[model samples]
Target chain A: MRAVEPEIVVVDYGAGNLRSVAKALERLGASPRVTSDPRALLRARGVVLPGVGSSGTAMAALEERRLVEPLRELMARGTPFFGVCLGMQLLFQTSEEDPRPCLGILPGRVRRLPGGLKVPHMGWNQVALLRPHPVFQDVPSGSEFYFVHSYYGEPADASLALGTTDYGVTFCSAVARGNLVATQFHPEKSGPTGLRLYENFLRLLVLEEARPLPWR
Target chain B: MLAKRIIPCLDVDAGRVVKGVRFLDHRDAGDPVELAAFYDREGADEVVFYDISASAQGRGIMRDVVARTAEQLFIPLAVGGGLRTVQDMRLMLKAGADKVSINTAAVQNPDLIGQGAAAFGRQCIVLGMDTLRVPGSSPPRWEVRTHTGRGGGRPTGLDAVEWAVRAVELGAGEIVVNSMDADGTQQGYDLDLLRAVSRAVSVPVVASGGAGDLEHLYQAIALGEADAVLAASIFHFRLYSIAQAKEYLAQRGVPVRRVPVPSGDR
Candidate 1:
């Protein structure tokens, strides 16, 4: 039986957490296509960028596949874009890792979190919503999400920050501006509450198509 | 929030499921594929198939069983026992095992842990340690044992709990602390061992051995602070269905996935 659901694309840039994110989207009744294919990504109602591991390596893969420019173009069109973990970090201007250049999609520098916070904060942490976004519509203010990362992004414009979490210090945990949304936590591993976020994203896709685009 | 996981451990020997008293009953339980399918339907969060037999013939049989079970089950599956080399881990992973566990091999060569983690991400590697409390020891020290609980060697000169902490630092994504004192006892989980290990490590801990009933599973979560509870004999014998176990745990306030009951089988 063919399933009728909104099509979503998860950017598989030879990184980590692609399968888990795809499965979580599936559970939310969205047909998620895990691909590095820029054409499919642009065609989707929304796109999820997921990554784990070094930022330098991730950027290289995206560059090699010629996805860096395409992704930027998609965001220019204001298609809803969500970045996760390293996926969230790559949207910034640069990273501390080798070669140091990033997509520069968001005006920010990705730096390693200072010592004493424990590298790769590998556990559940509570996130406080700063700006209201469609993704956090149903999600509570202090909802906990699963996070595993060594570095964090610091957006030049604090207005882009959608949520903040405290580890060694309060830092940006999620960001959203216009059709862009990104989270440092792996929503796929965050259990039921995380699943609800993905479901809300799917709902936003439906809503976006039903209503006229303000930019259009 | 981190998702709570429910895992079922299957003790396989010579390509078949085996259960007994203190790992010696030697009775044929059922086909590994059939049992895995049943567990998947019962909403088992994941399945672990431990190849207890280290013999060459037994190893061959285990590969076949892992392949069959992988084909039948969908959720994450982990395979352990006699996984000595990176190739061994890679083979199991290719056979559909989501994670590969190492015990004696890891102890023999601690570098294997880091090597495996580098080859495959830490999330796909697990360090399974067999532990037992030392007799007449002050402050209660737990020691590591090997060879299917037959001998203790090298001691790793490390405390059981401390070793677990080091294992995660050495790039183990998860730790499985199986208590020698609790294996097949069915009395209850050794909560003290579980608590110590769970506290010592930041990553998820799977409590194995000594889970006898529904209450035992609940205690493992509430008291031991374990992420998952693994049992062999109880599930093998049909003493408690996975559905019933999950329902009971969920009712007791332990976070568990609700599995639908099979039609005409309840």
Candidate 2:
């Protein structure tokens, strides 16, 4: 008999790189379902919201697919949620890239990287880990991760930031609060160190879910 | 600080990796998938696969190659060559390519850049320019060339610097300045063209063509002000490994991503 792999849902809302994110999860031996359906998201053992592009369009795509409220509800209930790139920015209250309100799950606005610097802060940059986190477990602090974006999330409360990276101006690169986690960089595209990040996130999800309740 | 990217470009024809000198005289390298994985293992920052084949059937084969390659590596894969429309961009991106580079088609349509960016976002669109220096032009100016499909380099009469700035305005996230005069010569990059475009655009500029040695790569960044350097012969011919080139740069105060050690080596 074959062992059943946990079903991880990758939210697909017409944003780019869904397959890349799904393939990375598949490489880690998990069965990833790429879907825009809210029901699929709710039933997922783990949910990854991977994105590229502008926050305004992404928010619109999520709204068009009716995934906005469900994603918000999932995060509110402490679901194991991982957001990447624009997915990380969409969790904010608003984005300067497009004049649209984001999910507002986190209390902050996404702002453009300061002027006089190249936009889309493309290529590899080091993420300075603020404190130990499970998802980044075994990943060294100040390690470089793949990033391609023009704007970054600025949380109203500073403690939500998990890591920060510098370009012209230092900005929050990763954030975690309770079961929710997100990275401004693309761990799925960051090679081995990135693959390890996925492994850590998946391992933590599986271990926590496999624990038997005291009542049982 | 962002690490300067060292990209190994694989010019793919049909299904195999091939290299051309000044967009002529094709030389077979190896399988695209294997070569990409090898580069990834060697700690290459990113790999670019340009589908040099012109036939429609060849395009289909490139898609398959992209799909197979995407399954193996976790790093970013950028696919270019003959991509014309937003649908074409969508097809390549769907096939697992992180970015789609538009060249000849972009020069003809121009709106395709904005359309692809609007449909898929600006980060997915890369503007590829084959530039040649206008002979005896005062202060040295470069003009754009396209139609590289059949080894034919057609002059577009557009200034390279002005076009780069315009393309960025049309929503291109990155620009690849491939100097036709310098390509395949392995002498060095056309620093003048690279610097002109780099200084004009607010987006990241990649210097391509004519990287003979480590010094050329360093010159592309330090002097040329290129955000990244794309080389083919130096890496494909095994003259210099990505690790060696990166080590050369890192030692000279240029920030580069440290090559991750293998598990056993650790």
Candidate 3:
């Protein structure tokens, strides 16, 4: 018997720079639909909240499309969720880039990358994995991932931290709780190691098919 | 700490990758998609493709090129040249390009920079500034050159370093400072120009043009203080590869992205 292919929905909230993410998923045999419609969000086997802009604008885009509640509902229902960059930031309560309220699915404030350490933190940086999650299976402990963000999530609950990378201040790179996972780096642009992470994420979906994810 | 990036720039004209010398003397290098995959396997931090030919007919081919390159590699791909409108940017970004660089077009409409940053966010809007020293200026300052010199060159009085800061203020997340004076010269980078721009900008500055040897690349980082260095001819002509450049940078103490060292060579 063959396993059903995961139908991943890449949330499109008008915060462009998502095609790369969708393309990466397509390469791994997952047909990801880039959509803002709430109905699609409900049906997705996996949901990717990929973002690349200020939190205020990003939240406004989500609000305009009325996806704020449906996304929360998707998580409440235990859909395997993934968020990238601003997408990861929006999963938290609030952000320094703006006063807009986030999904609050996770607890934290997305603060600026301190006062100094290079504004965008652009380039490949090594991530030190703190936890042994399935997403990181077969991936090395100190593998490098491409990063391009000015702010990182500071989750109120320290246990959510899975990977941390240092600039001037060491910050959280990947966080997880149950089957849901999010990352501050752009895995799609991170070369083969990045592709491995996605491959690992897809494996999580495969695992979900056998065992429905438990609620956090 | 974030490692310094060594980016290989693939300047493409028509459908094939071409090398640009001083933004002129376009010569065939290889297929854009093939070269990009090679660079990715060799451990390039990122790959930038400038669609030098923005012909009305060549536009479709360029999009296909960007799409094809993105299909093969996971590294960041930035395409510039011939993008005059936000729709042009939209087309490329939708074609799997992570960033859309604006050069002559940005100079023509400065507001376009802010527009791109507003629409796509600052990170996607890269300001590609081509600079050259004012021919008869008393203080010998670098001016932003508007034309590719393929057309008659138009040098703006705007100082390159100051313009970089203004462009960032307007929403350019990163700046690529290409020295017109040293672009094809390959003697070395315009360290003086690079150091000046690197000091002034709060955002990351990509020191482009004039890379002949590994030492030149090292200086672009260590002395020039550029956040990243862009190379064309040397890599195109086989004088150096991105792997060798990274190895040399490692030996010189400048932190860079590491690739698995191939066996049997030092």
Off by over 4 Å in 3: A212-216, B20-29, B135-140, B260-266
Candidate numbers sorted by DockQ from highest down: 2, 3, 1
Reference contacts preserved by each model: 0.04, 0.86, 0.78
TM-score of chain B of each: 0.90, 0.94, 0.91
Residue A119 of model 1, lDDT score: 49
Report the lDDT tens digits of candidate 2 across residue range B131-193: 889999989999999885546388899999999999999999999999988988889999888
Q: How many clashes in each structure?
A: 0, 0, 0
Error of 3 at B180 (Å): 1.6
Per-residue lDDT for A1-216 in model 2, tens only?
326566789999988888899898898888799999999887676799999877877888899999998898778767789999999999999999888899999999999999898988999999999999999988899899999998999999999999999999999999999888999999989988898889888987787577543322
Of the candidates shown, which would achieve the greatest TM-score relative to the real structure? 2
lDDT of candidates 1 onward, in order: 0.78, 0.89, 0.85
Pitting candidate 2 against candidate 3, the one with the higher lDDT is 2
Model 2's CAPRI class? medium
Q: Select the stronger candidate by DockQ from 1 and 2.
A: 2
C-alpha RMSD over true interface residues, model 3: 3.1
Supply the DockQ value of model 2: 0.78
Better of 2 and 3 by TM-score: 2
Model 1 lDDT vs. the true structure? Answer: 0.78
TM for every model, in the order presented, reads: 0.70, 0.95, 0.93
Sort by TM-score, best first: 2, 3, 1
What is the CAPRI rating of model 1's predicted complex?
A: incorrect
The DockQ values of the predictions, listed in order, are: 0.10, 0.78, 0.56
- Cα lDDT tens digits for candidate 1, B2-66: 33566788878888777631322343346777777667776676788889785988988888887
